[model samples]
Target chain A: MQLEEQTITIDGQKIPFQSGQTIMDAALAAKIYIPHLCYHPEFKPHGSCRLCTVMVNGRYESACTMPSVAGQEILNNTKELNENRRALTQMLFVEGNHICPGCPKTGNCQLQAVAYYVGMLSSHYQHFYPYRDLDPSHPDYVVDFNRCILCELCVRASRDVDKKNIFAISGRGIKAHLIINSPSGKLEDTDFAVGDKAAFVCPVGAILRKRTRYTTPIGERLYDKQSIRIVGDSQQLHAGATKYGRK
Target chain B: MIESLEGKRGVPRNRPPFPVTQGYLNKPTVVNNVETFALAARIAVYGGDGFAALGTKQSKGTKLLSISGDCLRPGIYEFPFGVSVREVLEACNAQDTQAVQISGAAGTCLSAKEFDRKIAFEDVATGGSVMIFNRQRDLLEVVRNFAHFFVHESCGFCTPCRVGTSLLKNLVEKVYTNHGTADDLKDMSYISQVLKTASHCGLGQTASNHIADTLKKFPEIYHKRLLVEANFEPAFDLDSALEDARQITGRKDEMAYL
Candidate 1:
């Protein structure tokens, strides 16, 4: 009976966590992993990825978005939640050009790890058939369009937190494209510097540091050994901040 | 306007020789919008007051709203004359909205802040309400998709609607894909304006006017990407330039995909 303890049950495990704690954060602290994307520790929580799906009291929800109310009973690690997570992951995988063999970050990628963890064997939807262009605009960084998932986490990080509305979604529906704020639609013309959150926010290998591809093997990558819940356990406070990150 | 129930199925490949030369059924036949005929009928029946009962005092009669947006409940709702947008949104349990796009696919778009404003014929057209897009929805993309619809449905009869709608689709897509220049936006604005005035039929002209209306209301949303002098770069990488080139390269050999 710690003063910080709150009465809550997650997947039938009664756990004591601090008040004002997020369900994801509390669950991760208690060793209950919730699959998630767009819930980064270094940056803000962006719930747009919708990959961290879980059920709370019989209702499906994005675990990354919902906050735990006192006396609430939450459920994660369910068959249905895992299925939906797998399906949504497969969608992002197939929607872009995710050639695992050709991708440098294949083993180390968060998106790939999520796919593997969720049991996404193959894609059910049609490949977007988009001809992605390689942006060699920055001499130190490279942007490959084929691997982007349109999560908008980078856009939010660059705009709301970073005070730069650098990213915007163009087109509609199936034909939607992401446009850089540069002349001739090239990233080189704009102030897109390396190490900016926009350049590295991609969960996939779409945007990569030019020389970092072969520097680290897939097994030693950040996403390989740890669950996203563990990495994002602290920053889950921002889950309900925006529409993208909300429950 | 010489119109017939029989002409419902097979439209003409070219202008009928008889409509202009011989005239409709050997008599001069002129075509007009059913709305005009309905108005004329209203003048005869209600003498404007009865029609006025449906709409506001200034705009008498029932008009439609093509509202397509993100609302807890979204659809065409018939309201009495002078019913404000706030009232309409309230009646539908869609109040406290994030955004509101008034008019049809081709009319003025106002956000939730503007919902307190009145809903009049001056605001919405005489046609039925078509759609309403909520804040979660994207307006630029909505109008762009609608333009594509018009482009494909065009009968290709008149230059203004057929050619003009296609041109409009191209322009709207260009603005959407971030390839449009400031000159392209100007051209887009100009083409929509001209088509609104010059298209032979209402379908070709008014059907796509939402693009113009949205641009007028939210011009910043439609600003061409490459043309804007800014320090920001998009978060996601886009390689549309190669796709555009590929399209141009294969245009001649490609079959139409409408």
Candidate 2:
């Protein structure tokens, strides 16, 4: 006996998927763009960012975690869904101090790219502008909490791939934040190395290597030339660059 | 047990690999609501059908309602499901009831016109809270209170709920303070739609329930509060802040900006 091939329709486009694959995985495989953050291909689907929420059979579900069922009708890229995504992206911009113009990762950042893709022109809501401390104690890298979107990619990469267990997310809700695992509560005190997968996993400028801030000109960057949709995968750009210690 | 070990924020986790499959310490666990346990205990004594026969087919068993506000007798009332809102109000001896808020702040706020609606899984579902409002009661004030409650309770994990709650609170308060415009009311409804569809959790999703329900049922209350001028007014009044400084310096001159 052979297993049956299954297909799901997304925004009138029929896409095939194997069993145990999520909608996000199937969509990405078919080159269908679904705006998302905190959903790196290499890491587990952390549904903290609700950007990829799509209507499935008249109900909303995060495409990153929701498994694709055969003959399932999904509504993506609709006016209502995109409007909601824009509002959610705007909330992310205001929740933290996301000053894209001043940040070093303005052009290359996934959050910035996703915001642009979603057409988030401004933070519609008032900015929280919470004061977060910047940790530059690590000899080889710096962890700027201000830019952290709490995607937990570094946490997953450090624990799952690097086996360093140097990063963990602490707190709940808006108070949720990234914390260093070492006793001194600093990245330098932890066993994290510059070559660890965690260092290169951050989709934003939150985690940056030392002495390589302005190496790449603003215009000549990854996302500057092409949007995140053209790049296909967020983790791909920084995948082989880990050994060189630059994003 | 998951929340007990994970701390008391009461936020739920994603499903598929539910707590029953892989939970605390990567071990299987059983999670149930407190009411479920109580229902189980009652079922052991009364039998399944005995408890089930009391209410509607879809929603069996009795419901515990926490009714308060303008009702003459405001307290807990246990009644079988499928009871009408008017029947509940009559039982509680409610006087001059204008509206009923079912299921706490996140529930629907029904006007007197909807009192005939029954309480059941098939009808108006509730999680055991019903607040009565008299005709003299201000609906905007009720909405303002519910808005503030959500703002205080928001865990701030996701963007929609965290920021949306604050935005709802400000908009509701703007109407309450009589500085609201028609655009503000429109923005509130739009924000509510965004919260319901995009929020990460149920709290953010339902935070706008009271505001939305009231806006639909009682648009006049909001329109009455709208400023006559068509000009946009900021949420905050700068002149109010100057009142404190004016009093401290005791300046009555025109330059003092009084």
Candidate 3:
């Protein structure tokens, strides 16, 4: 039996999709950008960052997890949605110590790129500045908890792709922190290698190569040349094709 | 789409794969409030029009209010929608009702001037709580209590709520203790705006409800308590440190050695 094609209207644009494709998947395939932080095309949509929330019909729903139904009206790129996105970015900044000036991933960071895309000038909320410890025990890499956004990308990559199960989130609420599953509770004690997907999956400067700091000049980095939107759109285009094993 | 059990922290899940389509072990499910179920039962017994005839166009059927504080008769009162705040106060024998906290801590704190506002979806939408405060009671104290409650109840899921509640609590206490500066007041408003728009769930989103509403409705209460004469002040006071030194030296003279 031939499958019927479906299309959804997002921000007044008609985007076509397969039967079970999510809004995010279809939008990415169409090269329509929806700013998101926790959503990596490689992993399952976590829906935790909430940066991808869009109005469906009249109700709010996260586009990352919501499936695309035929003729579904989705409102994205609106003032209300962007304003909310900017506020969420500010909250991420103030929630932890996201000091961008001295960070290694200054130009390549997804959080910073998305913040710039959403036009977040400053962290409008009060800074928590909760003291979190850093772990440099790993010979090749370091784990700086301060810059962590709790996106759980590393956690997912470590468990699913790497199959090491080295990283896990422990505690709840403000006390929640990324933990190592080893006996010593440190990355050095765990079996996490430098080449593992978890090490390279951190969207922020939290996980870094020990000696690669400032290797790429500030103005010559990934996001420094092209905006995250352009890079993300191209990346999504490739991700969409690869998902269905298409060229 | 699994329902969070009662007594657990009330953070909402992200929608899209909403409970209706994918919920509870990935099976299709329906989630409803207990009150909604009760209302459905009522509608089932009485025809839809019979229940719809009771309330305003926007808000249909009677609402159950949990009334308390400074009222002669404090208990559950069921009244149809579109009832004025003043009318509810009169029915409950509320004394000198300076303010009414409609819908618990996360709800709006309506001032005496807003008594004319009706309890409807178009006006003041409440979730059953109605706390009446007399003129003698301190509004700041009530706001402080609310701040503490949010701090204690925060689920720490996202950054905005986990640390935001504690910061809000500290700011409220700073204002309550008469150490608030003009900057503190500015920060309070800014934080409230951020929490309202950013937080992961309704709890953090409305965590600043009491502070924001009280600040707008009764500015004098907060303005009068501010001790700082300048636009800003350090987190600590040096004068308090000098007083501590004086007590340690057992010296009553003006010259305790500067």
Q: What is the TM-score of chain A alone in each candidate?
A: 0.82, 0.93, 0.92
Clashing pairs in 3: A173-B156, A174-B156
Tens-place lDDT per residue, model 3, A40-113, is 77788777777888888886767888888898999989988888788778878877899898888888888889
Q: After superposition, how far is residue A27 of candidate 2 from its true place, in Å?
A: 1.1
Q: What level of docking quality does candidate 3 show?
A: acceptable
TM-scores, all candidates, are 0.47, 0.88, 0.79
DockQ of each: 0.01, 0.50, 0.33
Model 2 ranges with Cα > 4 A deviation? A1-3, A181-184, A241-247, B1-11, B19-30, B228-231, B235-258
Per-residue lDDT value at A75 in model 2: 95
Sorted into a CAPRI-style docking class, model 2 comes out as medium
- Compared with the true structure, what per-residue lDDT tens digits does model 2 show for residues B139-253? 8888888888888887666667767888888778777878888888888999899889877778888999998998999888898999864646666567786888999999778
Which model, 2 or 3, shows the larger lDDT?
Answer: 2
Stretch of 10 with least lDDT, candidate 2 chain B: B1-10
For model 3, how does the per-residue alpha-carbon lDDT over B1-258 read when each residue is reduced to its tens digit? Answer: 164543333355666567778776667787887888999998998779988998799999989888999999999999999999999999999988899999999999999889999999999999889999999999999999999999877776665577668778888888888888888888888778767755667888899999899989998889999986677765555667588788888877867645
Ranking by DockQ: 2, 3, 1
